[model samples]
Every structure is written in structure tokens, then in C-alpha cells.
Target: MEVSIIIVSYNCKSFVFECIDSIKKLTELITYEVIVVDNNSSDGIEDDVVIRYPDILFFKNDYNGGFGYANNIGLAHAKGKYVFFLNPDTLLLNNVCQTLYDYLELNNNVAALGCRVYDENLNNQMSYGKFPSVIQYLLEVFPVKWVSDNYKNKISSEGYLTEDLDLDVEFISGADLFVRKSVLDHIGGFDENFFLFFEEVDLCMRIKNAGYQIRITSQAKLIHLMGQTMQVSFQKFKWFEESRYVFLRKYYSKKFIVFSKSIFIFRYLFLWLKYLDKEWHKRAVFIYKLK
Candidate 1:
């Protein structure tokens, strides 16, 4: 196969359905295979998607293994030269699969490629940017968001700035990444240590360390329905924080982890007091438990 398209799904049945349908409708020339790893979805997603799309390879996980683990499962079975990791909540505006594939085939140095991403309302989302650092995280959660925004704008994805058609970036959103199987094998897929967030960043770090380039291209486009599968709640926020710490522990220094933890404690406390809300307090305590 030329491409193996892997989508790690949870309980987002309708979103995955729409995503798959868009691929079938738009992709006309790419020789690709779709593998859907159902992460113990309870919404009858298997019945809803697998029955309808029998031609696609579907693996129903026995347990919830988070994003990286599930994608690893799909990767093991992939036979394509390139593997495209896509989110169930994203819809391709065009046959981006073929475009990215051709680019990789042409440029052997480019290990991975991320395309432009927009929301359902056509607002561009930052889908490419620098890897997270201790300094960057500290700035992001500052008291005044304006200060954080200034720093984030430098590292995070700002789709409005389109000066370069082919831009080399530190990392791409896991939502829409096309990567070579050789690079993935060399770096050993994604670090399963990351449960959810920062998994892409960790993978990109390894890819770059191995002397490969990760680039962003404006030649293709897609609509990413951000946060469609997971709802924003104390639990979700906890996982986000948890995975971030895991990422820091793996790549950063011990002193940085200590610094980040201290800041997190103070920030959560400030958030609780600032809002005087029970939810904020719960978030504070949840983070405290990590210590």
C-alpha cells in the first residue's frame, strides 16, 4: 500500500463517520488503507462504522489505551510506506493524502508533513508550531493572559501568518500528520508514556533528533472539529496536566520539573481564588495530588 491512514477513535461515532466519508469522496487517486482503532468505545461505534465500511481495517481495543497506544496498535498492522495519523473529528477539504504522499516521496529528508487546519466555521487553527518548553509553559499560564498570548503566538500555531508555503516547524498537531513508516519505526512510534496531550510533540522531538525534518505545507487543507470527542471537564484538564508533566519528566531536566510543579501549585491555587468556584478548587486539588 502507498499510505496507511490510522484514526484512533473513542466515542465519537458521528464525527468519525463524517471524516471517513469525506476521505472516500475526496481522495480519488491515492492508494491508501484506513485503519480505525476503537479505544473501547461504548457508543456502538463498531456497529455504526465497521458494519458500514467493511473494506476498512478495524481493530476494537479491549481497553482504553489512550491516543498513542491505540495508534501504535494500528501502526503494527499498517503495510503502507507512509502512515497518516488523523483525528476522527477532522474532515479533509481535499485529497490531502495524495498531496502529502507525493511530497514525501519527492523529498526524502522530510520525515513528516502537517497541512493547514481550519475549524468548521472556516477559522484557521494553529496546527503547526514549536515544541513546548519549560519557559513556554510558564508564560502560558501567567496571571495576565496577554503576556501568555505574546509568548504562545511565537511558538503555537497561528494560521493567520502564511508567509511561507513550505515551513519547517518543530511539531504538528497529531490531528492531521502524514509520516513515513521508516521514520516512525526508527523512532519507535509515539511514546506510550504520553496518555493524551503532548504525544505529538514528543514524537516530533524524536523525529528531529534522528535528523529528520518535520514541515508544514499550505498545499492541502482540512477542517478540524477541535475537542469533538472529549469534553472539557476537570477530568480532561487533569489528563492534560498529567501528560504534560510526563513529557517534561522524559525530556527536560529534573530542575525544570521541580520549577514547573511549583508553578502549577501556585497557579491552581490562584485560579481557585480568582474564580472562587468549586470547579476551580477541584482542579487545584487534582493537580496537588500529582505532587
Candidate 2:
């Protein structure tokens, strides 16, 4: 096969259906198979999906094993030269799979390629960026635009909306990542250590360490209906914070981790005061005292 498209599905039934339909309809001239790993979604959408898209390979985990692990499951079953880890909330604007495949065929040095990602409303999303550090994470939390502006100047814009075909980036979101299967096999796939966030960053880090560049291309495009399956909730926030800690510990120093936690606590405390959601307040407090 030319490409194996793997989607780690959750409870987004209609979104996944639309995503698969777009793939089937838009993708031509490339041989690809769709693998859907249902991470214990309780909505019974898996049954409907299986009945609707009989060509798709469907598997269900006994329990929710988180994103990275579920993707690892799909990777184990993949049988293509290239593997595309796509989110079920995405829609192909064109023949993105073939475009990415052609990019890899021509480039030869890039280990992974991500496409320009937009929201359902067509607003460009920040889908590629520098590898996260304490400073980068803190800048994201606080609204200091000047500091962020300087950072962007140094590292270049994380969000690529230009007409340039190739944009090199430190990491790309797993939401629409296309990777060479050989490179993935060499690095042993995504680090399953991350439960929700930073898994893609970790994978990109490994790919870079193996002397390969990760890039973004404007030639291919996709609409990511961000947060379709998982809405913003206190639990989701906790998972993000926990995964951030995991990433910091894995890649940075203890001093940096402590500094990040301190800034995160202060920022979230201020946000809690401003928003005044009791549930969010309690979760923010829990995160503050997480260590």
C-alpha cells in the first residue's frame, strides 16, 4: 500500500463518519487503507461506523488507553510505506494524502510532513511550532504579546499560512501528521509516555535526533474541527497539565519544571478568579498543588 491512514477515534460518531467519507471521496491516485482504533467509546458509534464503512478496518480497545497508546495499536497493524496519523475531526480539502506522499517522494530527507490546518470556520490553526520548553509553555499561558512576538521572530511563525509550499518546523500536531514508516519504525513510533499532549512533540524530537527534519506544507490542506470529541472541561485541563509535566520532566531540567509549574499555578489562579467557574476553580487549585 502507498499509505495507511490511522485515526484514533473517541466518541465522535458523526465527525468520524464525515472524516472517512471525505478521505474516500477526495483521495484518489493513491492506495490507502483506513484503520479506526476505537478507544473504548461508549456511544455505540463504532457499530454504526462498521456498518457504514465496511472497507475500513475497525478495532475496539477494552478500555481507553489514551491517544498515544491507541495510535501505537494502529501503528502495529499498519502495512504501508507511509503512515498518516489523522484525527477523526478533520476533513480533507483536497488530495492531501497524495500531496504529502509526493512531497516525501521528492524531499527524501524530511521524516514527517504536516499540512496547513484550519478550523471548520476556515481560521488557520497553530498546527506546527517549536518544541515546548518552560518558557514557551509560560508564554502560551500568559498574554504578553511582545514576548511572544520576539519568540516568534526568533523561531519563526509556528502557524504557517503562507503560499510557500514547504515550511520547516520543530514539531507538528499529530492531528494531521504524515510520516515515513521507516523513520517511525527506526524511532519506534510515538512515545507512549504521554497520555494526551506532547506525544507528537516527543515523536518529532526523536525524528530530529535521528537527523531528519519535520516540515509543514501549504500544498495540502485540511479542516480540523478542533475539539469535536473532547470539549474543554476541568478533566481535560487536568490531563493537559499532567501531560505537560510529563513532557517537562522527560525533556528538561528539574529547575525548569519547577519554574514552569510556578508560572502555571499563578496564571491559572488568575484565570480562575477572572472566569469564576467553581469546577474550573477547584481543578486549577488541584493543578496548583499537583506536585
TM-score of 2: 0.92
Q: Write the per-residue lDDT of candidate 2 for residues 1-291, one digit (tens) a residue.
A: 999999988888788899999999999999999999999998897769889998889989999888999999999999989999999999999999999999999999999999998888888876787866655665567647566565553453255454656778888987999999999888898777788977888888889989998999988999988787788887788788788777778888888877877776677677778887676567667766766
What lDDT is reached at residue 264 by model 2? 68
Error of 1 at 155 (Å): 2.7
Best by lDDT: 1
**Candidate 1 on 1-291: residue-level lDDT in tens?**
999999998988888889999999998787999999999989998886768998999999999989999999999999999999999999999889999999998999999999888889987787887766665666656635556555567755233334438888888888998999988888899888888988998898899999999998888889999987888887788889899878777888888877877787788788788888777777767766774
- Please list the C-alpha lDDT of all candidates, in the order they appear: 0.85, 0.84
How many clashes would you count in candidate 2?
0
Candidate 1: regions farther than 4 A off: 143-152, 157-164
